[model samples]
Target chain A: MKLKKNLALSETGFVFDPSNGNSFATNPIGLSIVKMLKEGKDIELIKKNILNEYLTDANTLEKDIYDFINMLKKLQLNENETSND
Target chain B: MKRKKITVAVTGLNAIDSPGPGVPVIRALKDSTYFDVRIIGLAYESMEPGIYMHDLVSKTYQIPLPSAGKASLLTRLKYIHAQEKIDVIIPNFDAELFNFITLADKLKKEFNIHTFMPSQAQFDERHKANLPEFGKKHGIKIPFSKMVFNVGEIPALKKEFSYPLVVKGKFYDASVAYTPEQAATYFNKIAAKWGLPIIIQEFVIGEELNVTAIGDGMGNTIGAVPMRKQYITDKGKAWSGISIDDEHLMKMTEQLFTSTKWKGGLELEIIKNAKGDYYLIEINPRFPAWVYLAVGCGQNHPEALVKMALGEKVKPYTKYDIGKMFIRYSFDMIVELKEFEKIATMGEL
Candidate 1:
């Protein structure tokens, strides 16, 4: 799933959605995943990147990534929802 | 350019659990770039916190409440104006607006005290009881509502409305009732405080949004800022909110001014459902307690209102910073007993 094109990700992990002016703060891992999504990386690539950089196992990483993506969808930060308008 | 000095009087200084707009309005005026203001706090109660906040209010004078009639209010204002040489008066209480609006012309003509306010006709049409007709006339979407004066009318409401409707007072207080019994209970409870014609409104589930805007009285919208409550207190007041970039909301606000030529500061309580439809919930005819959020967003509505009250021409603010948030916190100030005694006994401090 793609992130909203206009979502502004700051160096401090502050996420600002310009379309609706909603803001969110994420941890380092969540920030990295968001950055990866912004770069149009697929879910498998994101999962692999996180696994290589951290101590988590493949199964846990995959589940966490999917959960994070679902959160993005729930907050309406996905490109699909923005484009639907 | 040098700023002009002006003496201004403001009321509703009760900054408590459910805070009034006075303190924030004063904060905005103090931040004004156009004028240097000497704030005179007009209060109905001696315990109003703004009276004791010496840094914000230059002098505090106890005034009669709105129930004391306009004549008594005008007489007290005359006395205060005599001492303060007041240039403008801003009444911030919803309950006191009628007395202030009635005295607006007399205040200007007699004491040279300027006030920027909506006309009686404009004010009357936007009341809670008149909102449905107002929506129809202006082509704005509002939830269906009916006014009931007695408990006898509550049973008939089931025919026109469903369960989980809203029961509201004329001026303040609202409750969502899931059954007719709850509706009757809320009606009596609210009516006891605010008095009759309890309004029964259709409950439309949605994400609530609000817009604080200023109109120039000539169909020009000077500034508008839309916000969403990030956190709310138990009393339903916004503890924190963030400014949003909603083009549709801004357009709707501008269209409202264009159609009504509404003067002064107004807040539009709105509900936007999942289908993206906006329903006008209520219209508060003055600056809200959270108006400082608009100032933080770079619109500075109170500053604009002051300029308008002084007859200065103000251009519309075309842009404001979005994603700006305001987190409200309460503070306790320690005051000596002498200061309290002074206001309580002499009515001035």
Candidate 2:
């Protein structure tokens, strides 16, 4: 899934949606994931990168990434797309 | 350019649970780039926190309450104007606005003291009891509501409205009644406090949003800033809120001013339902307690109001920084009894 264009992600994990002026604060991993999504990174690539950099089982990481992507969709951070595959 | 020095008198110094717009209005005037303001605090109660905010207010004077009638109010204002050479007076309380609006011309003619306020007709038409007709006249959407003078009308309300509706007082207080008995209970409680003609409104379930704005009396909106409450207190006050970029809210504000030519400062209490329809909940006649949020968002409404009061041309502001947030907090000042005694007895501090 692709993140909305021009979502300002500050270094301190502050996410600002300029379109509606909604602001959110996320943890380091969420920030990185948002950054990666903004860069058009696919879900599998994001999952693989997190897996290589962090210590977590493939099953748990996959579940967490899908959960995070679902949350992004709920928050309207992701553009209209059905494929999280 | 040299800044002009002007003395301004303001009321509603109480900054408690339900705050008055006075302190924030003063703060905005202090931040004005065009005028050097000398703040004269007009208060009804000595314990009003703004009276003791020596850094913000130059001096404080006790004024008679609104129930004392316009003659007493005008007489007190005349005395204060003579002593301070007040350039403008901003009355911030809802109960006192009628007196201020009625006295605006006399205050201007007698002492050359200016006040930017809505006209009497404009003020009368926007009251809670008259809101439905106002919305109809302005082509704005308002929830269905009916005013009842007694609890006997509660039983009949079920025919017109469903349970879990809202029972509101004439001036203040509101509660959701899930049953006819509960509606009667709230009806008596609110009526005992604010008096008769209680309003029962259809409960519009949605996010509550507010727009604080200023109109130039000539049908031009000087500034408008919409915000959503992030945290609300039990008293229904916004403890923390953030500015939002909502074009529809802004358009509604402009249309309101363009239609009514509403002068002075006003706060529009709006509810946007899940279906994306906005219902105008209430129209407050003066600046709200969170007016500083508008200033924070770069509109500086009170500053523009002061300029307009002085007959200066103020162009409508086109932009403001979004995502600015305001968190309200309370502070205790260690003041000696002598300070309170001076204001209570001597009537000036």
Candidate 3:
């Protein structure tokens, strides 16, 4: 499903969710992933874009992306789409 | 003349590398209209002049710094086990805060005491690494930082953020760092030394400000005072300060208390960036030092806090006659230079 749903944003890139009342900080790329996730972008598309921009190798990039995505899940921002898989 | 009221003071070392909440608070409660003040110290001879607290206080209980681990702290904790006719147990340091949660109920049974401490969950949230998580969730900006557990976590971190990052403990430890490497080195040393977690934060240079306030258990505010750091010791302690009033800063306290339903005194620190953005640094769930400076300027935050806790209707704090400052310069040295030479061998290898 979607973990990046219903995030809050301020002009200075401050994002919070008043419901859970939690704050998160994102770098430019990380914000892009969150925004894309909010916009319903697929994880595969997000990973490809991150690889093209960052100098990291495929495996390192993939691992970090997965780790970050898992962290989002742990924070309950990620939505599980078990049916889609 | 009326007899003096009984008050209580809690303290730890007031030095650089001590981002503590005790010493200044002790000085504040001493001058209040509350109970005759008695100070319980983890550091000896804190404060200067007719102000060593031993002299100012009606009673004094001095405790040595606890050695690392459970046995040492438990040993020192025994000295204070059943002592003092204490009404309020003020934890001026984080270590004390953690200890008091367990000891609060224990002390209450022994001496009818009440302490203002955050829950275990709240305290875990206030720690350094957890800060980014907290900030990320609450729209707070802590200097962008990373967390480290052991010495091996050092090299994995590279200097991409900026120069002069801060290295601090997860919960109740001093922050130290100038560069990422310095931070890494510090983390490794402390990990080996103390066997705890640490974090590296990007340093944002700005003026440090804190709002100290009391919140009724209900969704209402009682009293709050805003302050600025005047001087910091070599160990990251706020040695001196002054009082100021800002409506926006005061509202943050209101909003935070209303949001968290926080039930005691809390101190919120923020750094005003050059562009005038107030980045949230951290929240300490206790009274701040230089709280007396609030009184000297006609606020008396500690007294207001006491009143609220005692269930008296508290007069809301509003007007502050600015330009009040607390300077921590050389007060008289307690021991002489020759005496320093003599005691230099006390804890030596």
Q: Quote the chain B TM-score of every prediction.
A: 0.98, 0.98, 0.76
Q: Return the lDDT, model 3, position B97.
A: 62
Q: Give one digit per residue, the lDDT tens place, for model 2 in B67-100.
A: 8999999888888887899998888888898989
lDDT of 3 at B176: 52
TM-score-based ranking: 1, 2, 3
lDDT of 1 by residue, B1-349 (tens): 7889998898879998888999999999998888899999999898899999999999999999788999999899988888999998898988899999999999888888999989988888889999999999999999999999998899889999999999999988889999989999999899999999899999999878899999999999999999998898887888888888777888899999999999999999998887778899899999999898888888888888888898989999999888888988888999999999999999999
lDDT of 3 at B8: 58
Alpha carbon lDDT at B208, candidate 2: 92
Better of 1 and 2 by DockQ: 1
**Residue B29 error, candidate 3, Å:** 2.3
Cα deviation of B132 in candidate 2 (Å)? Answer: 2.0
Native A-B contacts reproduced, model 3: 0.00
Where does candidate 2 chain B have its weakest 10-residue lDDT segment? B270-279
True contacts kept of each: 0.44, 0.30, 0.00
Predictions' DockQ, in order: 0.42, 0.27, 0.01
Best-performing candidate as measured by TM-score: 1
lDDT of 1 by residue, A1-85 (tens): 9898778999899999865668899999999999999999998898889998999998888788888999999998888764423
